[model samples]
Target: MTSTVSSDLRERAEAVLATLAGPGARLREDQWTAIHALVAERRRALVVQRTGWGKSAVYFVATALLRADGAGPTVIVSPLLALMRNQIDAAARAGIHAATVNSANTGDWERTYAAVASGEVDVLLVSPERLNNPDFRDRVLPQLTATAGMLVVDEAHCVSDWGHDFRPDYRRLRTLISELPAGIPVLATTATANDRVVVDVTEQLGLASGEPLVLRGSLDRESLRLSVVRLATPAQRLGWLADHLDALPGAGIIYTLTIAAAEEVADFLRERGHPVASYTGKTDPQERLAAEADLLDNRVKALVATSALGMGFDKPDLGFVVHLGAPASPVAYYQQIGRAGRAVERAEVVLLPGREDRDIWAYFASLAFPPEPLVRQTLAVLGDDAMSTAAVETRVDLSRTRLEMLLKVLDSDGAVRRVKGGWVATGEEWVYDRERHQRIAEARRAEQQAMLDYIDTTGCRMQFLRRQLDDPASERCGRCDTCTTPAWSTDVDQDAAAAAQERINRPGVEVAPRKQWPSGMAELGVGASGRIPATELAEPGRVIGRLSDIGWGTRLRELVDGDDAPVPGDVLDACVRVLAGWGWEQRPVGVVGIGSRTRPHQLDHLARRIAEIGRLPLLGTLTPAGPRPEAHANSPQRLAALWSAFEPPAFPVPNAPVLLVDDVIDSGWTATVAARLLRRAGASAVLPFALAQRG
Candidate 1:
């Protein structure tokens, strides 16, 4: 039933495959089917296959054939920089030219854009964020969408709000899809979408003429041996990893839920003489690339990482994946584990679930979209002007991250638009989908409960995951710990446990000073912008621990969230240790406490104890000049509230640096404003110190 053109296209696709996957390479039936749907029938298709299933091959081969037929360059919307690099290399192997535009390649964007315009580039890879960028959406995207031969959405599940890793930036793809010329074949792909996500994405990828061709294969990977090792405490978990990490077959990833955990575990392992690297959102782009290369070449035993290393990274021989804490959703967990057991005969996948996992999940859940009233308030703030995100933050009560996400959703809904300067109202009627958001929130809670169930389940681990993914052919794998005998030892040496406890118990994290004044301060009636004057800025400060740390975090959280109480003896001792190890250029000559509206007694006690320990004079306190504002205001509003709230004493302090004590530091705005007041009050220098730092 195939046409002559279809047969010729398949032949050319096979030739491209040989170039990409070596002479022994032949397209899998599904791969050819996907390619034919894209090239021969010009139909939109959604391919949901497991990792190492030749999904990338289908796109590359189809791109080669389409370009040979004089079609414009294929455009791939990738999710990560690492994925773009891998795809570029894969394209070159198939004799297809490719270029990328992302945050890392700003300097070369113009050159790359010119190359694509001149038909020298056969494909263009871009991050989902680029779809919403002002210049790209207005200038470059129209041209690209007009002429693009094939449009590929890699990690397409992100386009669905119900997906585990939903990103507002990915929703902008809807606008791009709607703008693409008719008959320009579209392909969407993901490795970890459940039935719900699959249905959502299929609906989102609706074609102009007909429904998309959906090809979802089985989610099972026979090579992965799954197991869960539940330890009593965080230290035991760390000890278990130290005891057994090397025994796991080959170089792999140790996943953590937070950046603090990643750094903590990586440092612990390195101290024990393991050649490991930490990869997280805070890591430098160039450093991430080097770490990936090191893992690829087997130069490092493992890369301790956060979810930042998820999605697009590829390593065919990855031998294992160990989780320091369970992700909130089984779908996300499956995706992380998929990075292992790709090309190898077998790979070990272990989960070390923590008691703190649900708390972390709840914290993230709090950032979901606010009610309709808050959304309307934001829309009302941007009447006619294009205000920067920070400017919008000043007017809204939401955190910076949540506010930006809401704006992106609004933009996608046509209620607003992102222009070169900032964001502007589109003057279009927008209906807030309250029911949809509620459904999503409920779904997220269910997913969290499912993750907890997964940890406690005594049944087959792979089968539980398959059921969570709603796989129709879900079955128990005989390779798991439950199906077979336990494959991993859960013993933790006493010395290793002691070492982990000691390392975690050691406190004091440097709190970097705010260097720049937040933007649009003028609008908030504050006269500051750009860099903070060096004289007014607080010197680098210190916190006993982060609110997310494994050791001091729990204690700090209890102190901050519990009823008013004096600083505990252990925390005070830790503070003393922090002071002893401060290594400050100039020692504090006196202590001053910032007045706390809620925890005045706690701050007062902390300041008095520090003064007693150092044998220094207790300077007068900084009193609150006015009533407190809302607790969850954005940076600029917080700055505005604190600008004139602190009343410093008129008398000058001793001729040495002053330690400004507080119960907790959240925005650093209060500390900045307090330091400025003390500096103006004739203190030699101000050093802000806190018991805890909230991220």
Candidate 2:
């Protein structure tokens, strides 16, 4: 407790809260506990909790308690528009007129200024940038000059440069808060914050001497099962994916790195007839809202998208998440996958890593850095005169978009000031000299390298993450793939090939050819000896045909010896047909194997009939090298589901409506392809479902 509040001040605060909230407004236990502590002790605390942990409630309750004890209206600075809107809506519902000064729904500047000055507003939510404005300082400082109530900084992690979503304006927050009268409390909240962030928050806000309260909620999500799969090639990966879908039948997410990749993958899956949604930055807000509703209503089963779609998303029961490629950094990876398993049920995270994933971030980093000379020139165009960010963009030689980005980086590095007309150079002059340009390039290079190292690290990824934030050295997380899975090879080799063969040859050999399954169905391929004729062999199904297609040209002796041979690459293509005869005497696919069942059941035959009519492939692989999870899921399921899941609802089809679903949708291409596929499948209408729509 560092309170300088006198008895009279405390009483005034109490009176204010009483006048606002009624006696019936009871706070919850956790809220009351934190509020009581903050009010009685006058302590500045950092609340670190997970989503739905009642962080906002605790602060609001504290505000009430302070008013009950004698404090003015609490001031809140928030970063998110949605968060602000939600809070405002809730406040209005509770009859607590909380006004926000965000980009949306502007209020009369004079009236807002007077309200804060007169202490008429209870809680004010504004962006951090607004606080740094000279206009706001002149207008709002007077009312807050008296040891008024409290100031809250939501999403405090944005202040740290190392944070995922660092904001340059957040750096000036401390200076702005310092302008407030001494003894006023400052509180900050974040759903995700580690220890270093806590320290950074307190120190940066000049609250080092203030009582620091740090708390962390549980990170364990028991419902999500974590797993990773290594892919030798893109085609194999697609096959594995088809199988994965068959096993896990429900609404899920598939994350990708680029807009093109998202679109491609989603389109590929959609062609197979899966009901998916594609989302990305390109999606309209109305379309995004519609997608959200579709997911909630179970209209789409999978969403293929980029990382843009999951922030602050409250979908608690996602079936699982699949990473199409490894993320650039652990922070990004963790946060993206964290969206799943929220329901604490049985869920899984699958990573299909490729060498190309290692290079994606570097490409992004190069674009992010631009040329230092270009950046300096752009800043020079803004001149020493204050100007708005947009105005500076207009004057710069670079594209308007690149100029804006360069401006943000420069602003963050403290090279320029963002003003009303355009950005203006601040502090010492910026030099686009050779050395400075080299240095800027070096820093950008280092940032990218660091991100790459995080991706390919051999040690505990979590420990590496901790180090990134300057956290105390921690032990390795024993559960990661590096610790759990055996290293296969720097490159694919003979031993892996032998193992794949063994997996294929394991007793009770069963070949689920592509011809036996529905189109777009997923399945795991077995690495077995080639059997069917050479011409028809390269196709997806016709069990023996697939085996021969993948094994063609390789001598029988090599296969028998389990020696590695070049995989018949063409056979794994998205299309190819089975051309062999001889349906094995195994039980039908998708039948529950209870104990010693060894023959195909009636249901399997029915599924095969449907595949024939639909011209779809079989559910599992014929080649016996190794089997991925998809083999099981794609090969078997309730027969009725296969057709109905992809079938558009009966009745009057929409007028020229297009439906597209993807694991990731960054651009409209994948969605468009999905829509086309839907139309081809007799869908009279098309809509899109994207797991994440980036911006």
Best model per TM-score? 1
C-alpha RMSD for every candidate: 1.5, 18.2
TM-score of 2: 0.55
At residue 544, give the lDDT of candidate 2: 16
TM-score of each: 0.98, 0.55
Question: lDDT per residue, candidate 2, 622-681, as tens digits?
Answer: 111122211111112221122222223223323333222122222233233233334443
| Model 1 agreement with the true structure over 527-626: per-residue lDDT tens digits | 9889987777799899999888877788889888887788889999999989899999999888989898898888899999999998988887988888
Per-candidate clashes, comma-separated? 0, 81
lDDT of candidate 1 vs native?
Answer: 0.89
Local distance difference test, each candidate: 0.89, 0.52
Residue 229 C-alpha lDDT in model 2: 68
Error of 2 at 131 (Å): 4.6
Error of 1 at 424 (Å): 1.2
lDDT of 2: 0.52
lDDT of 1 at 521: 82
